[model samples]
Target: GAGVSQSPSNKVTEKGKDVELRCDPISGHTALYWYRQSLGQGLEFLIYFQGNSAPDKSGLPSDRFSAERTGGSVSTLTIQRTQQEDSAVYLCASSTRTITGAVEAFFGQGTRLTVV
Candidate 1:
């Protein structure tokens, strides 16, 4: 894709339901990451994937949250039994090399999830 893409820019779900957010990273990027940010809060790392290996899931709040990257590109974040506290914007980023000290990340617009 020309840039990182995310689906369902806005999601509103009832408590205890499930919601799935998707991301499509830029072409040929080898690293991908997921982060969550609450209203007026900083971004919180959720997971990181370097390639075909297992994603670093340490950032997931609990077993209720999970994500997977398929074919080293697209990723999906699934939140099970959503709660009001889970409301936030989910962001995805991809990294690529650049000039010395100039490497930066590209971010998607993000999925705004609201659990009522």
Candidate 2:
């Protein structure tokens, strides 16, 4: 893909139902991240996958949310037993790692999830 791509721009689901969000990062990018933003809250880090290293899942809000990046490319975020508080815009970003320091990251339009 030319840039980070996410599916299901909008989602409306009943409480307790599970939802799966998908992301396709740019080619050659080694780092991918998942973030959550509420109505007024800042981007909350959820997870990170870099190359072949183990994913950094420290930022996940709870065990109900989990993500995985396969073959160092596409990624998926799954939320189980969704709750009303889970309603928000889920954002995905991908960046090319450089030797010196941080590099620019490309973000997807995000998936707006409304838990009814």
Candidate 3:
């Protein structure tokens, strides 16, 4: 993909149900990140994947939240037993190194999940 891509832009699920969000990062990008944004709230870092391994999982809100990246490209975020408070926009991003050694990340449009 030319940029990060997220699936099912909008989702409505009942409380206690589980939801899976998918993301496809740009080709050859080694760094991937997952974030959450609530209405009128700032972006909350959920997870960070460097290549096929995740070095930072502490940002996950709880055990019910988990994420994984395969082959350093695609990533998935899963939320179990969803609650109304879980409703928010989930975002994915990919970072790549430039010639100057600076890393810049490209972000997806985000998936909006509404728990009813």
Candidate 4:
């Protein structure tokens, strides 16, 4: 894909259900990130993947939230036992280099998850 691509633009799940969101980053990009945004809140970093080594899972809010990147190309975010508080737009981004430098991250349209 030319930029980051996220699946199932919108999803509605029960409060206790589990949901999986997918992301496909730009080809050759080395950095992938997952973020969450609530109705009026700012984007919160969820996880980061750099190359093929271990991913930086520091930003995950709890044990229920997890993500993995495969082959340095695609990534998935899984939320277990979803809660109403989990209803938000999940964004995925990828950059050619680490975010600290001058490079800019290309973002996906985001997947909106609603827990009822």
The candidate maximizing lDDT is 3
lDDT of 1 at 5: 93
Better of 1 and 3 by lDDT: 3
Superposed by TM-score, candidate 1 places the C-alpha of residue 62 at a distance from the truth, in angstroms, of: 0.5
Indicate whether candidate 2 or candidate 3 has the larger lDDT. 3
Tens digits of lDDT, candidate 1, 1-116: 89999998999999999999999988987788899999999999999887655447899999999888889878899999999999999999887644552247899999999998
Report the lDDT tens digits of candidate 3 across residue range 25-116.
Answer: 99999889999999999999999998989989989999999999988889999999999999999999999856675387899999999999
lDDT comparison, 2 vs 4, better candidate: 2
Runs of candidate 3 with Cα error greater than 4 angstroms are 98-102
lDDT of 1: 0.88
Alpha-carbon shift of residue 33 in model 3 (angstroms): 0.3
* Candidate 3 lDDT (Cα, 0 to 1): 0.93
Model 2: runs farther than 4 Å from truth? none
Name the lDDT of candidate 4: 0.90
Summarize candidate 4's per-residue lDDT along 1-116 as a digit string, tens digits.
77789998999999999999999999999888899999989999888888765457888999999888889888899999999999999999888874466388899999999999
Show the colliding residue pairs in model 3. Answer: none
Model 2 agreement with the true structure over 1-116: per-residue lDDT tens digits: 77789999999999999999999999999999999999988999999899745458899999999888889999999999999999999999999989985599999999999999
**How do all the candidates rank in terms of lDDT, highest first?**
3, 2, 4, 1
